[model samples]
Target: MAEGVGRGEILLRPLPCRAPPPDGAPVTGTLRLLLGDQLTRSITALDGLDPANDVVVMAEVQAEASYVRHHKQKIAFLFSAMRHFAAALEAEGVRVDYVRHDAPGNPGSLDGVVAAAVARHGPAHLVMTEPGEWRVRQMMEEWRETLPVPVHIRPDTRFVASHDDFADWARGRRQFRMEFFYREMRRKTGLLMADDAPAGGQWNFDAENRKRLPEGERLPDRRRFPPDAVTREVIALVERSFPDHFGTLEGFGWGVTREDALAALDDFIAYGLPRFGDYQDAMKAGADFLFHGLISPYLNAGLLTPLEVCRRAEAAWAEGHAPLNAVEGFIRQIIGWREFVRGLYWHEMPDYAATNHFDAHRPLPAFYWTGETDMACLAAVVDVTRRTAYAHHIQRLMVTGNFALLAGIAPREIEEWYLAVYADAYEWVELPNVHGM
Candidate 1:
């Protein structure tokens, strides 16, 4: 067994130490608050925005970045994406009040920065899409009561199902199984549906998607987005500000803009989807991503919406570009598993985070962070995670997650590691996944 470390005892590389309030100006029309994840242009918070009088607030704050010692690449990706999104809004004549994480007199927290923006712009109301995580939602609720202006928390329309929609489906049910929810989503969206029936006359092809990789099986060359000028600058900032954070920024190829994210989606549909189903669950030596759609980070970051991605996959199937099994499996992941977990999160949070069903209390092993271990599968997954800040679902579930479970690692410790290590991980998604495992 690997040596265990105490909770919050993970060593760091050591970094420089690092905020305040502002004065009030005349009240304006609205002050829109855009979190890093709320990068979509058509988000409800930006609805009916007035460029002349209203201002949008986007910030890179210390409190969010250091909340769990996030991966360096994850920080760079979000910060760069936020910067690009802000610039896009500015180009469209929307006035944006952006706060850099390294800017002088930064408030260093989401609420603090929003308060400062309220004082400076003095808007009549604050508008924002509801946050994904329960903790952040609680913070927004506090803002509603404490802020001097009215706050309008809009539903994040990017998701296929709203919280109420999920709650309605989950109401009085004895169990919350994803397969049943997935069928309902299929019926609701009419994706791969034929009149009143599923396209393949079935709800799931998951059993067909579990084949192991044959000898010398070929893989697609996944697209990589080279960091542009804005991304480069953000990378430098993260390197300087968070020298102690996990994961390296060496091979950081994730797209940091909407356009780049779309390109990635197209690339996956063309090259990765056809083979994705057969080998999505198959793991091989030295193959980090085998026919996997490497777009989760983009999806989670709001660069790509779940509905659009599912539609594209459906289109590929209709156009005969990919097989039905692959398309169905991919769609299920987004609309079925992804949506179900999100709904379950909102349904059971604030209590769910503390539910340790197995009561596993072993500390996380040091190899999880360093990838130094005799177990090849665990070592490989951790190594790739440290280098690229990514791992496919199977690798996460079967290797690292499985090891933690069997070794009896504490749920909170492993949960923190999952949240800290992956670019796509957020509390809303990560907590449910880790808790389930």
Candidate 2:
């Protein structure tokens, strides 16, 4: 059993076969299938869960972790977070059918484990939030046909904009631009909007956000969460299972739980957000994290919601805790670029992955994986990526991605590299960003 996992939570031992209640005593339980990314407690799938009969099924399968040679820390962070989330659910008396990757008879794939859980629980229905990737969405559709019970794939409500909203905004437009979509989201969410106009009398502050860091400027200290026992176990598991994966786990400091994520958010808003805009695009040697909010992984993984993050930043600006430029830029990232890419991904996926406008077919350079290059910019970004599995947008777009594009590296190869290396690299976000690049 995983550390802190309560009794009856681990599904290793065979559960007693639940006999049909006499004359339909209430209804059978709803089986909730929570993917690794759907760790939020209030996710739509769990909205009306009844602890008495409902069972939440979560699995740390090998397939997802090994799909693209994910960063070791990435794997560890997810597993640790999932485990923590399961434990928290169990503490609330929610029955969690948790499966560890190394558990005996582990099927090693999401569909397999979910099927096993269904067979064991004999649920009346299976519920899950919509997946983030096109391939996973296809798998969910397959589950609808294959599973014995009804499968409900609810829309993920954590995002600011829905798929329909994006589609409506994109309809009949020859060119899809994020600026307009962002303005719509601002109006829709009423974020940074005053009555009918945008805050600061403008919709964008990119012009004011490009100042280079002044010489010898003191950077704020970032909050780091040293590995606790749960995370340490996950680290050990990842190190033992994935010795050949990219990136190191030596200095793994990411917060895995919701509390930790909130603390990191507060830390960023208090210290980093004030100076975030000025040097968000600046890169300096020996400064891997310069005033940038290191909360993308948390946000992407559902520990933080997009609207809540944007609202907090907006509040910071309103309360004079951070400047308008910094707050607006940060909010734009969450509500604007993040939502826009997600919209683009779902809108054009299954075919979007095949669209390579450049038609470049050169192989990705060896140094993208090894960081063994002489070019200062490329080497620095790759080095940071290898050590931390993180690089700000500018580092991704301007440095590594630019090098790949200029060198005519195959889009698929570079796209796979981005997905494999970054902790926050999911297909919906990474693919669109790579395509845009």
Top candidate, metric lDDT? 2
Give the per-residue Cα lDDT of candidate 1 at 422: 92
**What's the CA RMSD of model 2 in angstroms?**
3.2
Steric clash pairs (candidate 2): none
Candidate 1 segments exceeding 4 Å error? 1-28
The collision pairs in model 1 are none
| Model 2, backbone clash pairs (residues 3+ apart or across chains), number | 0
- For each candidate, give its TM-score against the true structure: 0.93, 0.95
lDDT at 116, model 1: 75
Q: What's the C-alpha lDDT at position 239 in model 2?
A: 92
Q: What would the per-residue lDDT of candidate 1 be over residues 17-44, giving only the tens digit for each residue?
A: 1101124543347778888888889989
Candidate 1, residue 372: the lDDT equals: 84
Tens-place lDDT per residue, model 2, 200-249, is: 99999888899988899999888999999989988998899889999999
RMSD of every candidate to native, in Å, equals 7.8, 3.2
